[model samples]
Target chain A: MTVETLLLVAAALFGIGVYGALSQQSFVMIMMGLELMLSGAILATGTLWAMAAGGTPKGQLLAIVLVTVMAVEMAIGFALVVNVYRIRKADITEKLKTLRG
Target chain B: MTDVLFWIMSGISVLSAWRVFRTDSMVRAAYWLMVSFAAVAVILVLLSAEFLGLVLLLMLAGEMTIMAVFMVMFMMNPAGLNPMTMVHQHRAAIAAGVLSFLGLGAVGVFGRFPAGVSFATRDVTARLGMELLNDSMLIFQTAGVTLLATMIGALAIASRRGRYGLADEDSIEPAVENSQNAGEGPPSTEKGSA
Candidate 1:
């Protein structure tokens, strides 16, 4: 109903996303977390556009850019995951220690 | 009426996002994420961003399906037949999540944002189109190029064969002196001496 309410909801989504990203071992699950975080960002941006930005097209454009970023991130992330899985029979974060060096 | 719908969609998005990490099955997690996205799209529409909301739905449908397929392909327990806790540092993560939420929520509540309401009758989609083709044209073209590059890069990374050899195999360029041999065939498949 109000901008604050929408923003609070956005914050909640972002928080849950943080938990998911940090706690999950699976790469896909971690990505899901990032996606959730971006979802929050989109919602917040839309709320601001509707309530505070006087319906400016730039706010919506920003949201669209965020969406595009999400797509690029997902594409590259899955590609890396597939590659890693192919090279080593593992997908969890713990097993990616070889990447540290 | 709109207030009720807003609250409902907000609840749906948050709950489904929470469910994404809680579910054991990878497919369930991915689809749960999809549900969360769908609910957020509804909220966007309620906020009068009809075009953006619809586009979100369209983009996510394909993306989430791919995610589900990838989960099934790579996860050890795709169906979560065996209960497993594949997490570490759970307490710290929870603390961080809560703290970040509190901080952000406080900002949202306390921050003095400008007060302006969008007119419901305005054709936002047309305005957005004009913006894209006018002042924002460069940014729009840049995004298109970026997406094209991402597609090519993803393909190159995921493909089995690369410029030199099989991606899984140790790939090394053939020695320059061996040009005669290299010229006779497809990029040498021989695993180069490391």
Candidate 2:
């Protein structure tokens, strides 16, 4: 039951993140979507670890590693956003089509 | 008691997630996202993943605060007060979202899990450390190196050049001329412009 509940929640979060990533025009919103996806992944990992027999500690370790990756990703992403804003004075993702072919 | 706590945390997580997306203001969204992360961390703790829960809370709080600051500093509408639509391609997004959600929900609801019981009584932090060093030491070290590289790369990309490139003899002259040419108080350039 717990595993089912956790999977459902993870699926819901992943769906929402995908929706946000596809729909949102702001860079920050896209980042938020990515964060949501990461959160779902973390939850899934921790829950699966808990439910596994012999308690797979590796899953929990991976979750911690993912959290660190998320932090680093946010740091780099925000810094890039700040740089883009400095250059173009805009933050909307749609307006960033200059590099698109 | 455990089930009740689980339900409460789950409610908070889902509600705060919805609020994060539904709110118009970025700051409000960040605040709601923080709440959602915190609630999820609490749920992780309930599942006997206390170390993972605390790490999630700390990492998410730091990330959200940095994101909020970036939003304030970079977004054209810093206050998030301007009536601007942020979403696009809504119909396709919603359709894809709903399809995936239904598909995943069906799988989760109907799939049969293994009958093995959970062993959740171990101390999470010690076991995690042991596993990291024992089975996945290389992966752990690689992740640490990757984080270091990311930090350095961020600094490299974001750092701005100082006034070394400017003509030292006529720097103030150009500024005065430009200001005088524009009859208004000053050119309405964005902040941080040279």
Q: Model 1, range B1-194, lDDT digits (tens) per residue?
A: 99999899999999999888887888898899999999999999988899999999999999999999999998899988887878878999899889889988998899889976654446989999999999999999999999999999999989998877888785322233245566776435654532
Per-residue CA lDDT of candidate 2, range B1-194, in tens?
Answer: 98888888877887787777787778878878899889889988988888889877877777788778876766666566776767899989878767766777676677776647665785767878888888899888888888999888887667665345422222223233444656665555843385
Q: Model 1: which docking level applies?
A: medium
Off by over 4 Å in 1: B171-194
* Candidate 1 lDDT by residue in tens digits, A3-91: 88999999999999888888888898889988988998999999898899888898899999999999999999999998877876568
Report the poorest 10 consecutive residues by lDDT, candidate 2 chain A. A92-101
Listed models, DockQ each: 0.50, 0.46
Evaluated against the true structure, the overall lDDT of model 1 is: 0.88
lDDT to native, each model: 0.88, 0.75
Q: Could you tell me which 10 consecutive residues in candidate 1 chain B have the lowest summed lDDT?
A: B171-180
Residue A90 deviation, candidate 1, in Å? 1.9
- List per-candidate RMSD values in Å: 7.4, 7.3
